[model samples]
Target: MASVHPRVPESGIMSRPRPRHLAPVALLIVSALTLVGCGSDDESSEPPVASATEAEQETPGPDDEPTEPEDDTSLADFLRSAKVDDALVNRLGEVGDANGYGLGEGVETSLEERQQLATVQVGTCRDVAVGHRTWEGIQASDVSSGGTEEQAAAMADFLREEFCPHVAPYKEAPLPKQSLGGPEEDAKGGRGLASPVSWWDTRYRRVSWSEECAAQTGQPIGDPVAYRLSDDAVVCATVPPAEQLKKHLISVDVVFAEPVGEERAQDAALSLLPIDAVAEDETEGTNPDWSYLEGGCLNLNIQSQDLEDVVAGLKENAEPWAHAVHYSDGATADGAVGPYTGEVKQVSLSTGRNEPTDSGDLTC
Candidate 1:
């Protein structure tokens, strides 16, 4: 400039030349000082912009993980989060759904009307998790017909992980076999019928009664014979002896408040005895009164091949008989036959009068 640089315009200014390396250093220093000055001047100023790596480390990305679910989340909320069908969820919240879930009576009354819906939905899930109810059963039910297998499984898993952790082990556990009055304990001695009369005497006074005798013992007989023991009792017997004898072998004594007719006596006998032993024709043309017998006794023929099995069945069914006659009817009879004594033989029943003395005033 001092040596007379060519006529430069006034708008254009000329500056002294500097090293390129120093230029970059000076620029960085100026930026740092500007940031410092800004921070010092205003305590509330914005912070410095973060670098690419710093921003990534400090800020969450779209793929950031979610936190754990809260314990108090409602069943509908959970099911929706699990992607369960909305139709199924709404149906589950309907009234009387608790009973459908196997939550027996009083649920509606015990819980608030608002709470019942959630309770039922949660109960269904818990039952499925604990092996009390099946996922298939739930699917077949009206409430969950629209839900798929995956949705059902998810509900069970939700119950295990959230509501009831104790049910988790049962989720894989084998369901217990249904009981069908399984085989009873073996009869101790040779099987023969014994009366509950002896046991009844200890509890109530023994009533005495006379009986009319009848027999058809030689050949295989076609029909059972009825002997009236009292106004409320009748003894029906299979005429043919189980073995060679002059008396009936299988006898069923029925006692009730009403007078027992021949038809009633035959029906009662068939009910107590095994079906295989009775002829097909024997059941024909008979309108069996299926009403419960008040008090009764059975004399099992000692010669029977399945005496032990028959006795076991009788013992297993004793509770219902006791309930019907003794407890409900307020009778003094034990209502069930006594334990087998192994002493009653063909000769013991020779008189053909097999009345049971268990019922106090209603002996038969």
Candidate 2:
């Protein structure tokens, strides 16, 4: 997302992320025998787009496993066609794939060691909240959810259970937070787009945001099939419904040490997604899920966000992901508050040479 310039003009299609279930539609021409089976199936003529991370986490699906990958295209290919990196792609793909069985899901790459391990998991729900990254290391075996001070302290309880106490949990720092300033404040605790937005359109849809660190799962930074966490920390958000949003969640099980040496721990990821394996009508459309199903090695990264973003509902830049937005559709005007966060650390009003100060680097 940082690659695209702020002032760059957008075409008609790059506009919005709304009407999630929109697709090409046409009445089916079924055979005589096929007509009978139609009574049992309720088919939708619309095309399926990516689901949000919040919705997926609430509904359990295939995204919670590390060994299984949906039989669909890699998340990278999909986002690359849209505009993003492979690592981000893998992160988003898992979100789109989550259907049932997996809770939080997505791919992450990291090194493992004997006594310590660093792991990350990500996921996406239709509308629960934006995506996120998590960090887990030598603290895994005895790790705490960090839900609350008391919840974190509970790890010691398991350690003292005289019956069986081989492993336990411990408290760690809470995940970073983003300052709130958007529509999401009413429900979740993620950040929002900066004021005064700018807009655009892509692929015949209105896609707008000020800043986005989007992840598109299915492609690997080095591996694939990430995350297989259980469904404890997940909660459902409304924008997307229960069933449609359930198809995107990939959880990573990175039980390996971050400072991995000769004896590295094995990491795994598992997920259930909108496989769309059988395209009943070839003329109708191309089922997007076919590509990711053909799998590869899965990575479990211990990142700074949620357990599922395999489909990128909300991805951010740097480790401490901040809330940001992009504009689309005629929704934003030029010189808007959005796209405010730029990598441009330079001043432009200078003549022959630019002066530099503590403010930032200046360019003529």
Evaluate residue 197 in candidate 2 and report its C-alpha lDDT on the 0 to 100 scale: 12
Worst 10 residues of 1 by lDDT: 1-10
Kindly report which residue stretches of model 2 are placed more than 4 angstroms away from their true locations once superposed.
Answer: 1-71, 77-238, 241-364
- Per-residue alpha-carbon lDDT of model 1 for 1-364, expressed as tens digits? 0111110111011111111112222333222222223111114344588899998897877898877775432433424333444443433323233332213222332222223233334434544544434444444332233333554454444444544432111111121223232222112211112222122122222222222112111100122333333355444333221112222122233444443343444344333333332312210011112212222222321122333343333222221111001111111111212221221111112111122224312221
lDDT winner: 1
For model 1, the local distance difference test gives: 0.28
Residue pairs in collision within model 1: 356-364
Q: Determine which window of 10 residues in candidate 2 has minimal summed lDDT.
A: 195-204
TM-score of 1: 0.17
